[model samples]
Target: MSGAAVDAASGAPRRGEPRPKAAATNQQLRQQAVDRMIEAAIALIAVKGAAGLTLVDVGRAAGYSHTLPNYYFKSKNELLRQAYGRSVGAFRRRSGAWRRQALRAPVRDDALFSTMLAYVHGGCADPAGARAVNLIAAEAVTSLPGLLPEVRLQNERMLALLQDRIEAGACGTGAAEAPASIEALLVLAALRGLVSQHLLGVPAADVDAAVRMLHGFIEGGPAGGRSAA
Candidate 1:
């Protein structure tokens, strides 16, 4: 007790040394476990569709006992819901970045295409996103028609953003002749088609060329093709 607090066990802290903090609280630990479970769930859905995904599989994937996922979420549906929500939130954040960029830039269409390219290329670079997208599509077709209302709404907003940009860019150009919103929707449809093709094992190079072609069309028109500024 004289020099520094020393006992039969370890000694006391030294000068300028960072003190060891207390262990993580139960709430923190639980949250970490939940986060792991969610990540595992997303990864699993990406690899395999969510047809028969179970808490057991998720927990195992997360390197935890199956009971852990069960303790956090009661059912597979609940887990899927959480996973989808996370994916949507991620998409919103990415789109929002582009929206801000477009608002700040002189030409909005450029920013809008940049945004779409960001989303489209994200799927190419990140397989998990692609898998999740396919899973969502499969869910939409096989299980329910209007099952993903929130996803639909978010996508609609994205379309609106793209349309507004396209409309803005069309000023004083032949491409401006066509209705902006309609053209935006058509462009959106084209992108979706490309996504389908990519998911169906189409060559990425081909898909990328197709995207570039769409970009060309956006910049140019039926009369001629020109790279956008």
Candidate 2:
């Protein structure tokens, strides 16, 4: 008897017995395929840079037929956007975890500084992901206005943490003044610039030195402590 007949008689899904609720299974399969494609794309971008990424390449790397990526993503830009969104979400989660951990610690200034340093270092070490995040940030400034709300929320949370540390005298700044949001912005910008330079072939020692200098500045050292206007 045919597989379908056997399935009917045995009350089991035999071979390809129309798969009851197959739509759900198919949807799951599609999502899995898309995830694999995104992962492969990220790996490729890490190794080859975004300029070298192609949908066909992603499809082949993902173990899918050449047309599969096209089936899921209409264009390379869409894929890039999706990949970037995923990467940003992951970075935010990592930063959030560090923030939570820092908040739970003994409220030492060093602990807060160390947490920020670790978070930046983690991001810098992943060059492709870093680049992807920057690209998204640039795009958000123009093309994606909706992302601003989340970005602002994250910025506010980070600023609040820094301000709290500054106020608590944890920063050892001796300045008897709270740091302005601009100070936090400068610190973030400096770290990001240093990481971008490192990704462009700058030496680790140079990056380390720059990070130290910036940290010292934020902590009220001569280089970084001038009050924001």
Could you estimate the TM-score for every candidate?
Answer: 0.76, 0.61
lDDT of 1 by residue, 1-229 (tens): 6445553236556767777798999999998998889888888888877775788999999999978888888876677777877776675566566556656767534655666665565555556765775586569657734446645765688689788877766744446667777878888888767766777788877776676667667766743333532
In model 1, the clashing pairs are none
Cα lDDT, all candidates: 0.70, 0.68
lDDT of 1: 0.70
Residue by residue across 1-229, what tens digits does model 2's lDDT show?
A: 9867887898877764475653557789999999999988877766665555789999999999989999899887677667766776677677667667766777544644665565576676677777766655655577655455655665576677665654554455533343455566666767678777878888877676666666666666664534310
Local error of candidate 2 at residue 75 (angstroms) = 2.5
